[model samples]
Target: MLKQLSVAVLTAAGLLLPAAADASPARFLDQSTIPDLQRAMDRRQLTSEQLTRGYLRRIEELNPRLHAVVQTNPDALAAAKESDTRRRTHSSRSPLEGIPVLLKENTDTADRQTTTAGSTAMLGSRPAKDAFLVQRLRSAGAVVLGKANLSEWSNFRSTAQIPGWSGVAGQTRNPYALDRSPCGSSSGSAVAAAAGLATVAIGTETDGSIVCPAAATSTVGVKTSLGVVSRGGVVPITAQHDTPGPIARNVTDAALTLSVLAGADPADPASAAATFPKDLRLDRNALRGKRIGVWRKGHTGIDQQSDRIFESTVHTLRSLGATVVDGADVEDISWSVKPDLLPALLTEFKHDLNAYLAATPGDHPRNLSELIAYNDQHRDVEMPLFDQNLFVEANATDGNLNDQAYRRHRAAATGIAQRSIDDVLASNGLDAIVTLSGLPASPLDRPGDPRFLSSTRNTSVAGYPNITVPAGFAGPLPVGISFLGTKYHDAQLLSFAYAYEQATHARQAPRYLPAATG
Candidate 1:
């Protein structure tokens, strides 16, 4: 199955070139952050068109092996030329000017590329307008490089589906180790960012989608407080927990990207009630005199190497002038029980997805029921590996957000999650809670992989901000530590993450090894 998938992806990418032609021209792009690229452009040492073409060339050379990018923007060079013109006129829009960014396939761009969420069912579903976040990136003079492949329907399609597999694009391989999972459903975004396919990428997360992939690929992922970044035209998984955030090679790039994306949108009601921080500048001394709480409940005793690395991280934090509080776990919440989350997601997925399909101008399934039928009809293409049981369950729901049972379940889940994080913070008098973002990537194509462990659910359910940075490596695989903060505290969390990232500098460019190394 893996071999076949690899061939299919290579064929789909049209990467059957000679050995000489396969050599990448953008080796300098490796581990390059947005600020570094901006400075080069500012010094007239580089043009946006040059940077954009370099990335495009890299994607053409490497994407066949990693399957990170599913589509390349036809107008990307033109947009870069426009950015170059603006710079020539001394009218740069923002720090992101002339930077190339990859958008997760689920993000709507209203361009030549299709926003299919990596599913064949929505193959032609081109949204009428760009997602609010995409509009923000464009207005900031960022070039839309392409759409990165993702787990089909952002991993909401089935319970037994593979993490990075999709009907539209085959599996996305981890750049660090091709045989290991890239994690999902933001798999391609993180893989691309880690491999320098782009300067930065935007990924949406309902739960661990963004952070898990980022952690697995040794990149920085910021899952903003739900309303901090608008989800206006992005494909939905439940508006209550869905958000589009940045996945970059470093914390500063993620924070800078978030500043551009954070704004209220009248189209999304959730954004209206949220207050975005105006100043997103990070202070290297942000951790000094700050109380940081360590939540090691699920992180410890799992992997000895990870535990040792985390202990070192805690020591580093204390040495950097932080007051580290041990045993500040969110004891009120039970990780074993999630009675309301599934049903609530099913109800909300049905309701929200229907609305998104109806609003999108395209010839595709218009609702959950139609989507299920479409999958059923095209079983060979859509469900060859796993059945769409989640879609069937969602379709069974009444698709009403106003249903009493759904509303009650949603409220209970959100309340418990909020209290879990909030109570711990308040009782400990800490600025943020830190834990392992996720375990290292398991082997790809293993359906019931037990090595996966997630620590993003509480923050995801509470609709708060969470940022994950590379803490260390286990063998050739990367481990990330997450800093979770209360709602609307996105800026503060980024500052803390930035400070930690600068001190440790743990992230490394991927080597694209065939397997993990000791």
Candidate 2:
């Protein structure tokens, strides 16, 4: 399966690239920001077709080892040509114009690429239209570079599963360390962004999917408040928490991408009430007077090096003229216990996934029960690493949002999560809460669940915005610090993260080390 996928990806790359004699200079592609690329294009030094081909070549070169991209868009070069024509006509749309962006495989696109969600059960499934966010990207003149691999079913299929493994794409390796997990559902998005396979990528989070992978891969990820970016046409884990956001090598790119993606969508009811700032440009001085809260208890304590890095990060914040409030942990909370979250998520998954699959075009599983049965029938490929226990559990639910027990759990879980973040911020008088995004990426061969130290739960359950930026390194692996804020604070969080990122300049491109060293 892995060999066949690689052959398909390589063939796609071959089709996109120009012949060697006709190739353009692409040495400037590495670590190039959106503004930098735009400036280069403005100077007549580069074109969108060249940039797109450069990325396609990189994907072909690296994806054999990283498994980051599952498919490259057949229309990518044509889209780039269109962007070039628009630019020559002085009608460029947005900051993202001509940027090549990867979509996580779960994000539906009405094109040749399949929206499989990294599962063979949906191997040939197609969507009737572009996902709402994809529509926005196209409107902004961004090229849909390709579809990235992800944890199968967005990591909802099995509790025992590896973070970046999927039936279709195999495993996605961290760019920094091939032996380490990418900490995903958004695994490929983060890896591709970090490795410069694309200008940026879109990822969905239902808890730590976005931020966790961003931290692991040493990239920037913004988990916009739920509904800030519509979930329509994306594979659903649960509408209550799932949100599509940008993962990029820098905050400016992520923020710019978010500006394009954020808007109310009629197809997604959750987006109806959401609002966003007209401009999301970053302010380098945004953190000067901000009061940032530090939740020491949120530290995972598994990596002493990460703990030291967090302390250093706090000092850096203070040096940036920010007031640092220590020990601002969420009060009176069962930080270790989450009794209601599971039942609520399971029920919603059954209901929401059924709806999404039923609407998807092509012949495939149309409901949760059908998906489970398909897995059973193809156990060799789908269950090679882990069983679909979560699917079974979700299918056992009443699968109705109106069920009294489901409603109770949903309300209680969301309420507790909201209060946890809101009360802490209010008590501390904070602009944002800061903590380690999680422990550095764990080795893939280690048994049991990976130890994650992030405060992802509080923000995720409350449907708030969370941004993770590269803080520093723990040995050869990178660690990230998170800036989390209440709902609709997406722009503010971006500003804070941007300031910190500029001040520190801590992110380093991956060396693709075989393993980490102490």
Candidate 3:
């Protein structure tokens, strides 16, 4: 009860007095996720039409200024109409049957909306049908609320770039601190979830895309192991690193989204291990006496602000009866992984993306070389804020995925990361490792690019599961702490997060701001 009261107090105060504190219609409406809203609908308070209209109204009032939502599905109202029809005529829903959700624009919706990937090159093209993820959402009765704005090409188009800027969708401001940035490429998806534009939003991550944006936006984000969630129809990044995860205001919402979207899809070959656990919502005492190893390296020298917040989080976890064991540095953490990281990404990007693009024929550049050439051709709009240095470099590399050098590099990289994780857990008999999820929030854009260290690689290279929960604030900007562990430890990590959340309940909703200041 104390924890619940704290969450309510924090939510109320934070929503009303958020960093930057910009008013948003989206934040004012019934912004709960599908499950919470479903309960309200069941109580005969908000009909599906009313729910849909509220979000539409929010989108209308804010999208123009914030540029968070670009293309709302034309069929959204009709879909809501259908949901209302069912509610009045029938008795129950098929899970999220009437829930309105925003797809990250990278997700193919197969509706009137086109998946532009926030780029002008594919602005007008529409997929022949819904992407597999969208199809899953539809299968569970979710309304394709709209296509959200995202970092163009999911942030693969440029290097050292701004977070929320897109050629087609313009710039999506941080809902809490507009000047501070919402981080990307899942910027719009996380913002939509935070500002009440949608109940839930789906964001794809290659490196820090999903988790960074979620931390910056004060939402819950899960970055599954490489093959856990299907990457079937989502836009391509490095196939070895990409997974579409859930971003929501709470862990339960995220878990619920994961449950709805999990399972095997023949379309995405990597999703074979997508089996979810039964009874995902664990008890509040799940973390008592559980081993929690502290990852000290990831947080040692980042932001002074984030470090202070993470300290509070560690203290909180210890107070809740969790056995806290500190330290992550060892001979193996990144011993020889640094030299081989870029080569692997370049090789995988060129190989996997080409394969995925061949399936989706379009007028835009279809391959890595072509994309680099296209950027060279039109460097003005695409390279105005940042250069395509990463793409150009990757395009120049040889993708010898089958060669001796590639094999050695991949082996060494994974070996170091995985060994470090194992050493930490095994030495301490730990269930999960906790660390600062790190706010990769947007720095103020200027003549140069906004810069920050990428934190996703620590677990990504290891092929581990990671979950981020809201920890506390760094000057009103949200920072999160993570619980991660060895391969296929999704349930264990979730339970740890749930217990921490139940104890701390630290998350607060965003109040869209035009700028940030005390």
Give a tens-digit lDDT track for model 1, residues 1-518. 22332342244332122213223323345545677777767776667887777678778888999999999999999999999999999999998998899999999988899999998988879789999999999999999999999999999988898988889998999998899999999999999999888889999999889999999999999998989899998999999999899999899889889989989999998998877776778988999999999988767788888888899889988988999999987653445337888889999999899999988988899888889889889989998899999988998999888889988888999998898889999999999988888777888966423543457888898999889999999999999999998998888989899899999999877878888755
RMSD of each: 6.0, 5.5, 4.8
- Ten-residue region with minimum lDDT total, candidate 1: 14-23
For candidate 2, give the lDDT of residue 363: 85
Candidates ranked, most accurate by lDDT first: 2, 1, 3
Tens-place lDDT per residue, model 2, 274-298, is 9888676689899899999998774
Model 1: colliding residue pairs = none
lDDT of each: 0.86, 0.86, 0.73
What is the C-alpha local distance difference test score of candidate 2? 0.86
lDDT of 3 by residue, 256-304 (tens): 7777777678877777765577457666887878878777664646688
Clashing pairs for model 3 are 97-141
